[model samples]
Target: AAEHLAATRAGRRAPHRVAVAGSTYSVFPVRAGARTPQAVGVSREVRETVLSDWLLVVEADAGDWAEERLDLLYGVTQLIAVERDRRDAARTVRRRLAQEVLELVQTGAAPAEIAARLRVAAPVLLPGLGAAPHWQVVVARVEWEDGTAETGPVAQSLLEEILVDPHATGPEHSDRIAVAHTGDEAVALVPLPAVSTEHDGSETGVLADALLESVREPLSAGLDGDGRVTLGVSAAVHSAEGLRGA
Candidate 1:
């Protein structure tokens, strides 16, 4: 299977079936690893592309393996490809929202305009979170050893990865974070539940600390030894006017 993966990376596109330990497995090139747990699956060339080398292998009964099941697996893989494309397209729109909102705030756009944009962006960025949610601005920077590599997209990708919570039920539920890249920095716009009238936004400071704490280890490892990631989290802001200061 490893040899087949090597061949695939070397530009070979043919699928292969291999017998291992009395069982046969079907292998196919994938754009990314299967999110769901399967009897067999593997991913190689993780950083090669947005969709890297994903090897999907399915276990087969000794003599029960049939063309019908093989065809079913291929059909499922095609459905996964479509879902991946949809997810990528949706992410692009979310990133664009973040970028446009950031630009509006930085350029001192009218608060009404910013608020309007937020209204439009709420459904996409916050999903089921709510219509009027408090927002936090998290700024992250990646410095590489060579200092020549582009950091915006790298930071953007890392931000998205870090923001996902394992306990979340679905992609939309876990995707409360949206990131936009400006210059060499990636800024994440995180939505939180609105504060009660009795409390101020200071509670969000705790949330900010927790965000950093939760991601510190994984992010450090992802940056490796040659790069460093620095994060700055702002206090929660409930209004467009406060977003700039946040």
Candidate 2:
């Protein structure tokens, strides 16, 4: 997989094929009749504040953008940029709120104070929820076998991506999550809906297996051979009092 993006001269170039993760190297393969296909396109990088190595590849049928409907491509790129801006803003809020909540938790603040903070953070984190959801803690540590001072920030970014709710409706597009980093660790306060009466609580909330299911390979490749990430999920807790023990 090619992960690094590079500046390209103005126009389209055709490359056979390659693989990538959360890829932006856009390839628009066009075929005429039953012909196999002509592969070529332009690569434009979209600047996402959290993870910016995304490339947009556009392969065309005519070997160039002029009659290949370049206007439509520009529109698509603009749409993507706008959506990235929206998501990035939401993530910034989540990180800031997580930092505050983690500070209170670590300092052993009163449960009442913690609960109050959670209350204020709830609406922002879980917009459109009719009521506040139960909460859980997800703790992750990212470290290099060789070691580096950048571990904490890296962990924070990784956790944010992992915790996003792919099915989430509306603009936030994330689980009711607040993630903060301290030292080599990132802690996420994940908001969950209440368990139903007949169902076992065990069936609800995040599971370590499920959280890592899709991301395991990508995160591994990102570690550069000498780094690793470890994650743990806490049982759901109802209020601030349970946050510490969780």
Candidate 3:
């Protein structure tokens, strides 16, 4: 699989045969894995210039994937690419909204104006949300060992992945967090369910410690020699004015 991916052009989506030691997978893409040569499968790559790209490999229990089946697989890839584009477009809007909101908070905009903006943004940022949620802000920083890498988008992506609700699936997680990045820092505005009927904006202590402990080892392994991720979580706040303290 590594060899096949390495051999393929990252910028192209054309179907190509995946050749193995003694045989070829053809455009049907059934030969790269350990499965028997007769196992039915299809492979396709979805290329995205604006967002992350992915390869799709579909396997069947038995039989061969006839050449005629390639058309169906190709259609499936098209649908997937369409969905990817939709999600990417939505992410761009979410980021822009996040930037505007963050700027309002930092600049001390009128509370009524910010509240109105938040109200307008609620449906887009948290789809199908029942009631308002208390908001928490987490800021992340990525520091490279040699200090040459562009860390803003990297940290932004990392925080998006890290903050996703673990119980949800796929793009559903994308709508739940608004992240904006500048320079080497990414600020994530996360919404948590209101814990009680009444709430005071008190400091939530040690969020960073608990989060750091859970993520450090696995993150360290993935980083290997790249860099480190640092995170700090603020006290949950309920109103637009409260966002300043958050």
The regions of model 3 sitting more than 4 angstroms off are 1-86, 128-130, 169-171, 195-210
Q: Each candidate: what lDDT?
A: 0.65, 0.62, 0.60
TM-score (C-alpha) between model 1 and the true structure = 0.61
lDDT of 3 at 153: 81
Task: TM-score winner between 2 and 3, please give it.
Answer: 2
Name the better of 1 and 3 by TM-score.
Answer: 1
- Number of the predicted model whose TM-score against the real structure is largest: 2
TM-score, every prediction:
0.61, 0.66, 0.58
Clashing pairs in 2: 14-40, 24-55, 26-57, 40-59, 41-58, 41-59
What digit string (tens of lDDT, one per residue) describes model 3 on residues 42-146? 243111011112345544311255645655665555566577567667788778877888888878899888887777677776666678766788998887777
Tens digits of lDDT, candidate 2, 7-68: 11112243222345543343422211211122223222211111212234643332344634
Q: Residue 84 of candidate 2: its Cα lDDT? A: 57
Compose the digit string of candidate 1's lDDT tens values, residues 55-94. 4676753134465655566667667767767766778878
Query: Per-prediction count of colliding residue pairs?
Result: 0, 6, 0
